[model samples]
Target: MPEPLGDDLVLLFAALASTTQAEITAALADAGYGDLRPSDGYLVQHLQHGPVSIGDLAGKLGITAQGVSKTVIEMERKGYVSRTPAPEDQRTRLVDLTEKGWAAIYATRRARAHVNRELRAALGSGASAFLDQVRHLAENSGALAALSERRLRP
Candidate 1:
């Protein structure tokens, strides 16, 4: 029979996945938005700062331009973002956040902060510090940083 996964590995993976999902769901709820997932927020954040092309947003999210275009269309329909003709290139359109998008992003940030605070409190000072150290170590790895940067640009 195959060996079971190690305790540390299981805990780490479960914690990472659950925390990400919980944080995302909480943020969306706090923003008074529904039907928007973390992937939506990821795209919204990039467009929130300013206008960007579909290709650029795709590159930032490490997805294909076609995929980004589809998501952008959905978001546009939801009134979170708008696509307008780029001044420099008539063929390409740039995506920009609407007021609703800005509000959502702001609320997400605030909700995430609250979640982090609650986590810290639950973990206690020492455990929280240790957990942060672990997170930093995991995040600071060269390959991980590269992957994250590729996925999250803005």
Candidate 2:
């Protein structure tokens, strides 16, 4: 069998991913976000792009419609989102971000910047640059393209 990557490398990558997310979440909380989680951020970011049906959000998030509904309900309770009947389809409701959601998203963006600074300090310029380049490469790879296709397909 081909040699596997070193355990240290695998652990490093895992730690990096976890730390990045934790730092961003902490940053969002610091900026006045309540009931914040990575999933919540995903919902806000997608809704920020445009209104979406619960089914679409569930598909994008790789979650069940029931799970998405639960998350949406929590967000609604926290005033981060609101549901409005879709004009095109009265049977469907579109989830839209409220002012609170916008604020939460903005705070999360700022927090991510702070986390990026920490990453720069920890990884140094060279490793950081390499990570960025590799991320772009992976994002453009066939695997990612296939995943994206799956997401867009009905």
lDDT of 2 by residue, 1-154 (tens): 7446565655767788798888787777768874777857666656867789999888887889998899899989999999998999998889999998888877877888878777678777587688777677658766467554444222
Give the Å shift of residue 127 in candidate 2: 4.5
Tens-digit lDDT track for model 1 on 8-127? 665767787688668768668755787667778678767655899999988888889999999999989988899999998899999999888887777777777787677678788687
Clashing residue pairs in candidate 2, if any?
A: none
Question: What lDDT score is found at residue 63 in candidate 2?
Answer: 83
Candidate 1: which pairs clash? none
Number of clashing residue pairs, candidate 2: 0
